[model samples]
Target: MSNVTGSFQLMKSLNRSLVLNKIRSAGAVSRAAIAKETKLTPPTVTNIVNELIESNLVRESEMGTSKGGRKPVLLTINDQEFFIIGLDVGARKIRGVLTDLNAKELVADHAALYQDISADQLTERMTQMIEDLIQSAGVERTQVVGVGVGMHGIVDHEQGVARFAPTYHLKEIPIKEQLETAVKLPVFVENDAKAMALGELWFGAGRGCDNLIAVNIGVGIGAGIIFNNRLYHGHNAVAGELGHTIIDINGSPCSCGSFGCLQTVAGGDSIAERAARELASGRESLLREKIAGKDEINGEIVYECALAGDQLCIDILQETGRYLGVGMTNVINLMNPAKLIIGGGVSKAGDFILGPLQDVVSQRALTDEVKQTNISTAELQEHATVIGAVTIVLADLFTPDLLNAK
Candidate 1:
């Protein structure tokens, strides 16, 4: 009799999660709609929704229009009842955002680190930044349930350790433990690119797609891979280091100590560095007049100059895109994803970069079907990683364990 009761309770919890996810996806849904979507009995849906409402996780909204009967009341997630914090720790900056359960940013703040800083200093600064973001948003500390952090490096998500960050020249830092102790909250850490991929999967371009790739092109390059509607962290949790793929065995050196890696040609820093070198060698371009000094010539300035028809900037982007296409072709041949989302600052070049990239992918990928993969700029842009950090918490909240606990 006890075993039968336990089985029934497990089924009930599963049913509740199914109904809650149905309503969450629909945004505003009627009870009948949830029942239909979840294929659960109307009474079961009613009981689950009532429990959710009583728990303040869901609320009844306006009445829905009737289909020749009494109008049904609609339900919506109580997004404002809880909050999540997202942090993006990049090589040049550390950004933090306070967001509601729906991943909408309430407030955000960032601090620049132009030079390399110690792991301790970085943690201290990040902890204070979280405090500042929470205070600026005027949210109660208890309301903030969890914090998610995304950083550039090979991160061991399970252990919450940063194995290595080539950009920061750091190794084996227990970032998650430090931040969690400092802030006194649950903390989850992930590679920035993987976080960006999760952001797209939950709320951005890859929302409806199961197989997707989010490639982030900034000072360096990295990819987040989603397979079968789940994030694929390879056996060692380093499956998506697409940037370090060797496209040329004897080309320019990369920061990762590899020769002719894809990033050396396509990354934002490489593009800007190439442009600066050209300008230093007495090559005349509109960029010369647009910038105050040689140090001012970066990826953003190069992109802006390209938009203004500067030939040098245009040529540099075209070359970078061509190299990117070579790297992406390798990705497509291996993964054959449904969507390839290009993100980070470099994607702002838009057609100037994508046009050349698409051209190369068409010529290089294995088959016509593989080449047909949809490639586009990330919809979330600068906010992808930050919002993805918030989704890390949301993902946990939606897990079966937590749902069953509730």
Candidate 2:
């Protein structure tokens, strides 16, 4: 009897989720339309819609077009009733955004982090940032459904712990619990690259794309994989650590203690270091005049010099692109995704990097069809991870159990 009861409950939950998702996708839909689209009975759709209306998740809008009778009432998601907060915690900085259910940004802010800051201090700072974001957006704390955090590390989402972050030298940090205690809100945490992928999936380039990869290249490199319209976290929830994948057996040592890792050649730090080394060796270029010293040479400076037609800077980015292409070739031959998105601060180099990167992928990929994967820079640019953080809460809100609950 218990098994039967559980099964029935599950079915009801699934039905409610289906109805809600239909209405959400349609923007404004009628019960008859939802019933028809979901292939559920009219009575079931009516019950779920009423429940959603009571929960303030869905509301009756203007009348729909007539279908040979009285105009049907249209239902729409109550987007303004609640909000979400998304945080992207990087090695050098932390960014936050307040957004609606549709992932539209209402307010955004950021703060820099020194290399020596402890995890506890970082958590406290993040708590204050969340409060400031809510206040800046002019929304009451009660209006926020939850907070989501995206960090660069192996995050145990179920445990709400950051297991490892090599860049920050952090390990086993209880980020979720600490932040929740400080802010008094439900918190969800995930890997930054994975969050960027989710952001693309729902609101950016990956919208309607089931098979895609969002590769983030900044101080370090990582990828977020989407297979069959879902984020693939693997068995240990760390599937997309593409940066650690060794591309050259004789390459420079990586922070991960691995040799020939992709990040050693293609990451922002790697590019900046290579450019600085070249400048120190007296390789004449326009960068010398653009910056006061070699210490000032960074990825952004290199990109700017390259954009201004500096041959050495252009060469450096071209070589970095080749390395990135080598890594991307391996990814393509393995996953065969339909779309590949390049993200992170370094990707801002635009054609100075992508042209060479795409050329390498096209030449090295195993098959012509595999090389056909559409490659483009991230549409959201700096905002991807933060917006994706909000999706964590949105995903929970749309879950079957939550959607069906009274």
Candidate 3:
């Protein structure tokens, strides 16, 4: 390519990126507004915006009425123009969703695993699923920013290695490199709980809150901490292992080989185990009817019964909440976050889980801390972590250097 041609191409790319950034920062705006904010000439803004329109990245909306002359055409990011893929890998299933720039779901697909799949098989299946999602969403290959996977375990984001995931029996696997090589696009791996926390911080209940903590109550308890307006992953990406916190010195054994950890008492498996035993002993409640012939019970079943107002189900939830609250009170004392958000499948019980939770928090937490902090359920439900994964890709893809590079 000619040097002059290359220079012009570089300039065009930088200008387009700048225009896109302006729209992202300001929301729906006019070309004049972008020019003013970016300090670029009106002609440059107009040219860049036209290129964006051709690329389907931005769109022109109705013009506002002018007090004197012609109305200015309003510009808005085409939330539907492009998409990103997000996958949340859980012990029981793999949930994938394709979303637009605004994080609106376009298509979603999930697969259940009877048993753990090998790392290679998992990545291969996940790649196929992503291809299916793109075709299902009718998005072009170039339109997708990348894929982000939220895994349950210690993640080395810098190296893209999943140190270990007990649920999947995976250890020290290069998740990002493998997925990226297979899918031929950028890939990111993050702790599932941390991803959910970012999702909450960006677009869910934690929006506008700088200091927040998101506790994920699922197969096992985990936490996502956002401190000083940034997601805090700690030194080795193990900062939010709240479930492993020793709550009882002689308590029930945990998978981590510890005694009296929060996971021993509040994890989904533990909850199911307790319910099973209670039912076997002929507890008089709807749970017996719900699991009449079933040999095993799961967290979802428990939540359904709890929502149905089964006396035994409510009792279980209340007791679980009490224990969770005890842990949370400690969280408040340690993090002192502005708000605490609860998420994951168990959160489906809503106030059945949160009401008793708060009661305990009030009782155990420092009176002053309790008064200053608030607790709420995650607004994104099961989608928080997945959407947060997508956010990670977008934030990385749209940075000044990357977006502006020719």
Candidate 4:
């Protein structure tokens, strides 16, 4: 009897969520329209919608045009009053945003991450940012639905733990537990790149593509995989470690302790290292004028120089693109995602890198269709990862009672 009751409740919840999502997708819809679209009986739709309205998540709007006589009352999502907080945890900084239910950013804030900061210290900084963002947005804490964090490295999203944040050399950090404890709000933690994929799906480049990949090529390389409109977290949650894929057994040593991982040659850190090495080898370029020494020649500086038309910087970016193309080809052949979206600092190089990367893909991909697989830059730019942080909470909120887990 108990199991049967539980199943009944689950079905009801699923139907409610279905009706709500139909309303959301339809923008402004009549109750009859929602019932027809979701295949729910009118009575069930009415009950669920009434419950949603009471919960302040849905509302009755203006009347829709009538076919003949009476106009239908339009129903819409109560998005304006709802809020969510998003955080992007990076190697040296943590960026945050306050957004509405529609994921429109309302306020943004950030804090630095010292190289040697402890796990507890990091959570403190994140909690403080969430607090500060709520104040900045002038919203009551209760108005904010939840906090979402996009953390780098292997993340146990189910447990809301950052299993390993490579930048801080931290392991098994209890991000969700600590933040929820501090803020008294729900917290979700996800890998930075995975979050970016979700953000792109709903609000950016990967929109309209159910199966896609978003690669973040920053200080390190990472990838987020979305299949059938859902994130694919592999067994043990290391599914998107695209950076650690070994392409060059005898190539340079990677931070992952592997020889010739894709990140070793294509990541932002590698871009800078390559530039610095050229400079150290007495290759002359405009970078020498901007930097005091080779050590100061980071990836951003190299990009700046490239934009300033430094031939060496441009060539290095081109080479990096080719390497990325090679790495992407392997994955494309393996996964054959509908699209590949590139994000992060190195991607900011734009045509300097993209042209070559595309060239390599065009020349090397196994099939003609695969070669033309709609590779584009991430639409959200630098905010991609952070906004993705906001999206995890949104995903949870939107997918509460789905029959199949996303």
Candidate 5:
């Protein structure tokens, strides 16, 4: 009896979510349209929609164009009434966004991360940032349905624990549990890249794409993969660790203690290292005039110099692109994703980086068809990861996962 009751309840919830999402994706949809499209009977759609309307998640909007008799009433998601808190916890900074149910930004906040900070300190900073976001938005705590965290490094998404953060040298941090406790709401944690990939799928470049890879090339390089419209986490949940992919057996040492890893050669920090090395070798370029020493140098400085037509900066970026291409080529040949999206700080280099990366792909991919694989920069740019975090909560609220019944 209990099992039957559980199944019925689960199906009811799914039907409700189905009707709500149809209205959300349509921007404005009639009840008849949702029933026709979802294949749900009109009575079932009405009951579910009524529940959603009672919950303030769905509302009747303008009437649809008349077909024959009376006009049908259209429905829309209560996009602004509810809120979600999203955080992007990176190596050097913790960034956050307060977004509506539609993923529209309401408030943004950020705080720096010290190199020697402990796991506890990191959690404290993250918690403080969440509190600040809610306060800044002046929204009631109950109005926020959930909190989503996009954390870099190896994440145990199911457990909501960060297994290992290579950059932070921390392990087994229970992010979801802690945040949920602090905020008294559901909290979701995922690898930053995976979250970004889902975000792209939901609202950015990957909207209609079924199979794609969204790569984040920042202080470290990571990838988020979607296969057949679903996020694919490998057997060990480390499916998209693109940075650690060995590219050069005899290349520079990586933080992972491996020699010739892709990140050691193509990541944001790596870009700065290469530029600083060239400057150290007394290469005559604009970087020499911009900064005093290697300690003060970073990827943004290199990009600025490259924009000023500095050949050395341009070369470094191009070289980074070539190395990234080598890595991406391996990925393309293996996964055969329909599109490859480049995001993260390093991706800001634009043509100086993408041109060479595409050139390498055009030259090296397996066949003519594969070489035509579309490679593009991220649409959301700086907000990509953070928006992705918001999508975590939004997806849970709007998407109907059958497993929830299990």
Candidate 6:
């Protein structure tokens, strides 16, 4: 096909995919509802729905009882028509999940890496794990639509590349292409925080809502923004670098070559390091004892201690939460998102962190802005990124042309 003709065809396919995706994510709905939700024309939604039904990707359900008119036929996704795989790769662990068309988690598995394996080895292990999962789920390979990967780093999603991921030692790596080639399936790669955002948008806290932000606090801090009812990647797919934002210019050095970034203070590594220091200084706390024999402690240990009412641990978490509140105040002022969801390891500090974090933000942020935005703990926790990977695959399936080669 000629270039222009191919482009037009791609757009048409993408439009159809987008419409179908909306319906699937939004659940049972009529063509009118779909059109209204997606801002597509009624005729266009009708046409897309017809095509999807014919393709066995969507089906019509019982008609809705009308208030004052004819019943509207409800459209539903064909859950058995397709399957998606989501992978979340972290420095300390790797998690994978199988989700159906509706983004429901069907099965999940996790494994820890000994901190020495190379990227190539990680890929091999992931591939093997996926195969095992597919067999265990008893799903046909042909029914598998694609795989989505949530890796920690700066990712160019449009190009399917990880530009700079210190945790994974990845640099300009074509993670999408490599995985797609090996698995013989289309693959989408995204930063872990952004994946969590998608996860919230489709299945978790931000479901059916627009204009939300999900902050992931792990070994590093990152954010995923959903704006105008879409995942916003900003100019270079690095828009939500909340972790790198300088909170103190002359304070501690950050891994991002900056000073006093949120991650440098509140990230898992930083929290653990501070806890270690406190223990070394003979400060009494449960965490101090927990890390006595271990070379290192993680955020999980800190949270556990805080939960047990250890004064030192509670104080550390509250301090971290206060810093996080400062950063979140900036985010709230800039984006004015309707919801701010917090996830990752450090969030396990639970109400200890959330209560203080919310109090500070409420006090510092603009009153009107704070009133409109709801800051809450993430329900999905660590699994948000992996589930979000599944959501991304499903989204691509519904809008294949959006990801076509240019």
Write down the TM-score for model 4. 0.94
Can you tell me which runs of candidate 3 are displaced by over 4 Å?
A: 1-21, 30-56, 59-65, 280-282, 398-406
User: Candidate 6, which segments miss by more than 4 Å at Cα?
Assistant: 1-12, 29-50, 60-74, 399-406
Error of 2 at 15 (Å): 3.6
Q: Candidate 3, TM-score vs. the true structure? A: 0.86
RMSD of each: 5.3, 4.9, 4.7, 4.0, 3.8, 4.4
Judged by lDDT against the true structure, how good is candidate 4?
A: 0.86
Q: Residue by residue across 1-406, what tens digits does model 5's lDDT show?
A: 1232223234456677788778888999988889899999999999888877876677887768886887778999887777889999998999999999878899999999988888888888998999899899998776787788999999888889999998889999999888777767678898999889988888898888989999999999999998877788888788999999999889889998888999999999899888878888989989887886555789999999999999999999999999989999999999999999999999999999999999999999999998989999889887889999999877776773511211
> Which candidate's lDDT is highest?
5
Top of the candidates by TM-score: 4
**Regions of candidate 2 where Cα sits further than 4 Å from its true position:** 1-13, 293-295, 399-406
lDDT of 1 by residue, 146-255 (tens): 78888887988877888988877988989889987888777888889989998998889998898999998888899988887777778888888988999999899988
Clashing pairs in 5: none
TM-score of 5: 0.94
List the candidates' TM-scores in order: 0.89, 0.93, 0.86, 0.94, 0.94, 0.87
| Model 1's TM-score against the true structure | 0.89
Error of 4 at 91 (Å): 1.6
lDDT-superior candidate, 1 or 4: 4
Q: What local lDDT does model 2 show for residue 394?
A: 76
lDDT of 6 by residue, 165-215 (tens): 777565787777777667766678888998899888877998877789999
Backbone clash pairs for candidate 3 read: none
C-alpha lDDT (0 to 100) for residue 302 of candidate 1 = 92
Pairing residues by index, what is the TM-score of model 2? 0.93
Give the per-residue lDDT of model 3 (tens digit) for 174-285: 8888887777667888888988987887789998887999999898888988887777878767888999999889899888778999988888888898888887798877
Ranking of predictions according to lDDT: 5, 4, 2, 1, 6, 3
Clashes of 6: 1
Worst 10 residues of 4 by lDDT: 1-10
